[model samples]
Target: MQGKRSNQIVQNTAFLYFRMLLSMGIGLYASRIVLEVLGVEDFGVFNVVGGVVSMLTFLNNSLSSASQRFLTFELGKNNIMELSKVFNISVSIHLAIAGLVVLLAETVGLWFLYHKLSIPPERFDAALWVYHFCVLTAFFGILQAPYIAMIISREEMSLFAYISILETVLRLLIVYLLKVIMFDKLSLYGILTFSVSFFIFLLYWQLCRKRFVETRIKHFIWDRKRYIQILSFSGWVLNGNLAVVGYTQGVNILLNIFFGPAVNAARGIAFQLQNAVNNFSYNFQKAMNPQITKSYASGDMGLMHRLVFVSSKVTFFLTLIPCIPILIETNFFLEKWLGKFPDHTISFVRISVLITIISALSYSMIVSIHSTGTIKKFQLWEANILLMIVPISYFLLKKGGTPEVAYWTTLVLMIIAQSARVVIVSKAIDFKLYTYFNEVILRILLGLPLCLILPYWVFVNMNEGWSRLIILVVVVCISVGLSFYFLVCSKSEQRILNKVGFGFVAKFQALISRYSLNK
Candidate 1:
């Protein structure tokens, strides 16, 4: 079972890596095209508008998490029939929620456009169109919540990866179509892209139906008790989502309101870079999620604990490795890929990366805590901090008089939230926060010195041109390689190396078998 699990992890990791590469490739090209085509103000306007509407997705996304947790837990118990019931129940709930979100979007969305954000009158129509299309996409996505969770529970990562790649490719295709056609109706572009994504989600839903017997929606009615339970879970989740909304989308909107679209463009670039770097770690977490759920359900506390620790370390380093180049070559990479923009983008990217790294580490712990039933406690504290984020951010952005101030407020808030969660996790899971800090947190600390060195070296020596990009990449590779060798690797890793042995061992065995067959 251990060997099988190891092999499965290896396979899933490979698939995830492939998916990230594809997604990043699309991101690189798409960022360049969008930046060039839309210009800073329009691009920023789109982001601000989209960010506002995106808050509506909070409940759907949060509920999907609950669904994933329940589905994977059932799968862990090998309760196939119950898994189907959970799927149906989750889908039923999600549909109802999506309907509510759509109705809100149609009625309240326009008022949000005119009053809440900083979109200029000339750009309002364009922004509104983008928001409308995004609303439709969100609706489609929320409705497919159970299908996505089912795929994760089954560990059918390849299907998810393929679907994701197709989605990115389709999005890219839509961008190119908009560029070539040069459509005056910019909203139509938003509509087209989202409609395609919706169709793809439908395809995934159909595939889920064919693949999982448990995915069938029978004549199931919602139990008042279960409905209330789900709603109660979603209510807390809605608060958490609101916090996320405030921290992420709220910050963007605030930036737009105070700083204008140009600064928002810079923020957008920084955010894209943050999101891209985030995808690297996301791949591993997604792969391990089902395993974590299964381990917890079976009361395999030892394995579950081990998996949590290992995942944190691996994800930490995986993200840390690439961020070095990003920090070093932020301007060159941005200018080279997406052309020049506001001056503060590089700083924003660097600061945001630091915050994202810390948050991502704490998030791993959160995922582990989530496997247990103690989510509400964590959620409550996180929500409080999250709620604080908005007022604090608004004051910070308004008073500190810089875009970076907004990020600083966010960083401080995330740190407090993460620290509080550490305490919560320690009490709930009996996992020592100091041990996690010593192991995972210390590696990050050691890595920071190295990450700092590359940028300093690049700034001193290399200036401009492709060599800068090359040098940055090389330094990042060497630094990360050395850091892991010294800080992360252990005797266990070396033993695995020895078990795999030299590449020639398998080749030699094959050769001997061939000779015997011929003789």
Candidate 2:
């Protein structure tokens, strides 16, 4: 059973990585084209306006987390009936949340957008169009949450990957159309983007209905106990999600107010790179998340702990592989990717990479805490720590701090938040903080320097060009790969790697010999 689970994880991770690679490639290209078509000011307007709607979608995020946890826990117990019930209830809750979002977005979100945002007077109308489309996109996304949760809980990663690829391709097509079609590029982009989202939602809805019995709602479930359970979990989750939204989107609004749309454009470009790089770790974490939840639900604390520990280390290494190259070659990459990106783009990308590295280590721990379904205290602490970023950033920007100060603030707060998570997780699951520090943090600290030394040295000595970039990437990969194998991985993990490597070579040789004999 353990071997089977491990194989499944490997297979799912492969599918997700395929999806990430294609999506990231196409997404980076599409973003470059969009920037060229829309120009910086319009791009900034879209980012900030869309961010306002995303702020309210934190409600959707909170409930999405709850839905996945409950569904996965029930599936782990093989409670088919309860799984269906949970899905229906989750659908109900998401519907309510979706309506609430529409209300908040129109009244409060709209008012704030018009009154508080720093858009040019000419672009105000375009921003409003973007806001409405974003609301529609969020509405569809909220309604689609339960089906997505069901797919993920069941570990239907191949289908998830397929849908994600389709979505990315559609968005790419939308960007292409933005260039050809000639009606208010900003407004048209917003509408086309929403169309892609709505179409993707329908795909998920139909796929879940056809594939999973749990998704076929025969009747509305009004389980008071289940409602209380999910809502209780999500309520605390809401606090953490709110803080995340506040720091991210809220800070984007602040940048717009303080530094104007051009700066917001820079931040947007930075985040595009951040997302591209971070997807390496995020895909792995997504593949591991279901296993963590299922293991805990089956009361396999030992297995769960091992998964969390190994995954935390692996996530950091995965993030570091791409991050190291980009961190060293930010300006080169940005100039090549976006011919004329906004100011501060390089600083934002560098700082965002650092932030992503710290945050990557927390994914497995967060999943483990959610699996236990006792996130009240955990979420409270994380929320309080992360929530500090926005106000502190506001104060700094008000006191004439530059735009990068906001990202620096986020980096510091992220460190504090991750530390608090480790401490809380230690108590909640009886996780040994000493073991975590020694096995994960300590090893990373030692190995990271080794990973960077060669790459940085090559970067500094070499001139800036495509050849240098290629060599730097190769050097970083080799350096990080060796450090991960020798310094980060435990003896048991090394043995597994050796076994897998030998097995693959043996299989290849046997296949070749058999084919030669037949010939």
Candidate 3:
């Protein structure tokens, strides 16, 4: 059973890695094309409009999380009937919610568009087109929660990886179409791409329903009790979602109000880059969420605890390793790739990286809270802490602080919120945050000096582009090799190394095979 579980984990992790590479890779490449195609103004228009939709999507996002959790838990408990009921109830609720959102977008969202948003009169119609299509896309996208939940529950993560790749390829194809057909109509380009995305999501969901028994909608029946249970769990979840969206998208909106669409475009670039980096680590957590939920349901706290710690450690290192280079080379990267420096994007990336490092450590605790159904109390505390950002951010900006100040303020709020959450969970679970920190955090803290020193040496010693490239390669090799040896590789690591044919047993096996009598 242990070996089987280990294999399952490796398979899941491999799927997540591929998915992250494909999705984030496409995003990074396509962002350059998109900026060139749309130019600054329209690109800003699209992001500003999309940010509004993101705020609304927050309501359904957390609810979808609830759907995934309940589905995984029921499957783990071997309660097929309850799982079916959850499926139907969740779908029914989402359909209702999606309808209401469309109605609100048409009415309230429209009013805010003309009045609250800082759009030039010339761009109004184009922005409206983008907004309408975004609303439609979101409506259709929300209905796939049950199918997505089913896939996660069954641990068919490779399917998700394929879907991410397919979606990205389709979006790139849309970009090509924009070049040929739409020309400079960035609004229409956004609308067309969103329409295409909706169709792709629906197609995947339909395929899952047809292929998997657990996904068949016919097996599901509406149950009021199930509806109540999901909603009750999701209510506190909604508070956290609202708080997060308020601070994140709300900050974008605030930027639009204070500055203009151009500034929002700069903010968009920084956010997309931050999101791309974050998704690299987040994909692992997302893939493990179902397994974590299942383990919690089945009373396997030991495995759950092990997964939690491993996730924290691996996520930290993965995020930290790439971030050093990104931090050091931010201006060079932006200028080289985007043809110009996006305003405030560099500072936003810097402060946001700090926020991500703090938040990544807290994800393990958050997972424990979600799995054990002890998230209710923490939700309120977390939400309150997040809410403090709004007033503090406003006051700082009003006092003439730049975007950098706002970014740091936001980061501090996130750290405080995450720390409060860890404390709450520690009280409930009787496991200190320091337990994981003492083991993993030191590697990150100590290795970071090497991360910085190597990169700084490369940047300083290399003047020419080719020389810089060579120096970067050398520095990366030496830095990572030394860091792994001193910071991460240990006896326990050796045991895993043996399993993967890299340790003493592996060397012994290779020697025996080389000198075997069969030869």
- Per-prediction TM-score to the true structure, in the order listed: 0.92, 0.97, 0.92
- What's the C-alpha lDDT at position 23 in model 2? 97
**Candidate 3: lDDT of 183?**
44
Write down the lDDT of every candidate, Cα atoms only: 0.78, 0.92, 0.77
- 1-519 per-residue lDDT for model 2 (tens digits): 765676678778889999999999999999999999999999999999999999999988999999999999999999999999999999999999999999999999999997899899998898899999999999999999999999999999999999999999999999889989979999999999999999999999999999998899988989999999999999999999989897789889899999899999998988878888889888989999999999899999888888999899989999998999898888889889889888889899999999999989889878989999999999999999899999999999999999999999999999999999999998888878899999899999989898999999998899999999999989988999999999989999888667655655776799999999999
Of 2 and 3, the candidate ranking higher by lDDT? 2
lDDT computed for candidate 1:
0.78
Prediction 3 global C-alpha lDDT: 0.77
Give me the candidate number with maximum lDDT. 2
Candidate RMSDs in Å, in order, are 3.4, 1.9, 3.8
Models sorted by TM-score, best on top: 2, 1, 3
Ten-residue segment with the worst summed lDDT in candidate 2? Answer: 496-505
Which has the higher TM-score value, candidate number 1 or candidate number 2? 2
lDDT digits (tens) for residues 365-460 of candidate 3 = 776787777678988999888877777888888888787766788888887887787678767666666875665566567666776687788788
For each candidate, how many residue pairs have backbone atoms clashing (under 3 Å)? 0, 0, 0
